[model samples]
Target: MAAKRILIIDDEADVREIAKVSLEITKNWDVATAASGEEGVTLASTYHPDAILLDVMMPKVDGLATLVKLNENINTCKIPVILLTATIRLATQPAYVEAGAKAVLIKPFDPALLGGQIESVLGW
Candidate 1:
């Protein structure tokens, strides 16, 4: 099977690096990173990644707004998006789910388990 391609959108450079390295080394996935939601949206259309790991909080174009934009575009609407958030409030999970997030991963995550979590969420 072809390696899964994943796009990660996060403002923090460290977070993006961690996720990119973790996914690549652990799963041998093709990974890409975008510093903001707008960039992510643009890359999503062109790259056609199998999935997206989106940060919930950002300075401009937060995750929810980005998700909306992605859903609005026919080219990206079907791609699964998993939210990476520092917030663990139960109330927010459904909101993200309603906004079309495939899953949510809390911040300070274990890099080793990240791939497994994503696979479980995507049912891969």
Candidate 2:
């Protein structure tokens, strides 16, 4: 099978790098990363990744807003998005789901299991 492409959007450089490496090493996915929401949108347009790992708290455009914009675009709307946040409340799950995110990833995730978790959500 062709390697699945994934785009990770995070404000923290370390987080982005870790996620990139984890996905690459564990899943052998085609991974691209952006440090901000704006960059993420641009990368998404150009890369057309199969899935996106988006961070919730970011400058300029937050994850929720970014997710909204992504869903508005025909080219990106179909791509599954898993939102990453430090705080995941039960009350917020419905809102995230309604906003088109496939799943909510609590921060401080297990790097070893991240790829498998994502694949499960994508039903790969």
TM-scores, one per candidate: 0.98, 0.97
The TM-score of candidate 2 is 0.97
Model 2 residue 63 lDDT score: 96
Model 2: lDDT equals: 0.94
Q: Pick the candidate with the highest lDDT.
A: 1
Model 2, span 40-106: residue lDDT tens: 9888998999999999989899999999999998889999999999988899889889999999998
Candidate 2 residue-wise lDDT at 51: 99
- Model 2: colliding residue pairs: none
**Which lDDT value does model 1 have at 102?**
92
Error of 2 at 119 (Å): 0.6
Per-residue lDDT of candidate 1, residues 3-93 (tens digit): 9999999999999999999999999999999999999999999999999999999997999999999999999999999999997699778
* Candidate 2 segments exceeding 4 Å error: none
Which residue pairs does candidate 1 place in steric collision? Answer: none
